[model samples]
Target: MSFTLERAQAAEPKILANGMKSFDHFRKLAGIPKLDEFFVDAGELEQLLPGLPLSGDSALDKLSMLADNDYRTYAVGLTRWNTSGGLERKREVEYPPASNKIGYFNGLALVEIWVIDPPVVKASCGHTVVNPLHLALSYSDDKRIFDERVSLELGNMLEELGYEFENRWS
Candidate 1:
């Protein structure tokens, strides 16, 4: 389905309300030290949630399995760009040549779960410290396949815990 920011924003509150406690449970299981580190390994998720139903390399396949079991899924596609040259340059070359792929995922995958009372704090020095309650999964260079696996496993766990699951690409 085509993703709309308005729809996503409207859905956020419900997702957060339903998934907050469960999200915290998974975060503790993953041993995440910070909030922004939303992604976890499939192995870790499996270890934490032994009864999850989906597995393997393909995100689509896993998502299909979840749908069969009556879970809602959404996919969002994301593109990363080099913005070191500032806003004007960013607009000028939105999609740079392939040579500039370093430090960027031309098509990165992200799975986000909403949460309430995100653990974010602003320090006296004015720096924001984020300890998010939401969940997001992404593929890293070293473990390219794990992102899909983790996202699927997370969905299974959330369902088991009595929350609706939505998968987004962005």
Candidate 2:
């Protein structure tokens, strides 16, 4: 999971505007869903319909780091979901600018996962410098220990993260 915060310019509005454009540019390049960023507030986590571990700090950190700097923070957690039984696939990228590249792609990965009595999953797709399909499939496989609901919900949640998705089931 990742969180971002942005300190918008209170001074010249142009700075804010430039900042916004850069933010959007990176957001688009990173393949983050604009909607997810909008609806999910860090403060609203405690009040969400379902009890979730997600918080506003994660979201804030994501937004804050979009500027010409590295300011994003992330956390990792694990949960279980039903699977067809198989080896989960994984990949590694070896290159320079790992942080920024990772940051760019990581910022776009908007997933709302839960460590509830029963876990939940949702996945979404989008365009970016990186292949969202790869990211989505990795997530699906990672959480395969859960049920279809988790997968389905994961898809929706991912879409909320800023990816354009088509429901093959629907």
**TM-score of each predicted structure versus truth:** 0.21, 0.19
Lowest summed lDDT window (length 10), candidate 1: 84-93
Q: Write the per-residue lDDT of candidate 1 for residues 8-126, one digit (tens) a residue.
A: 33343443554543443333243322112122333433343332222112223333342211221111112211111111111111212233445342222222222222233342434
With a 3 Å backbone cut-off (N, CA, C), the pairs that clash in candidate 1 are 35-132, 74-167, 76-169
lDDT of 2 by residue, 1-170 (tens): 22111222222222132122232223223332111121222232223322332222232222222122232111112232122121122222222224554344432322232222211223121111112222232332223233344345434434545432233232
Candidate 1: residue 103 lDDT (0-100): 38
TM-score for candidate 1: 0.21
Which has the greatest lDDT?
1
lDDT of 1: 0.29
The candidate that achieves the highest TM-score relative to the unseen native structure: 1
How much lDDT does each candidate structure score? 0.29, 0.27
lDDT of 2 at 8: 26
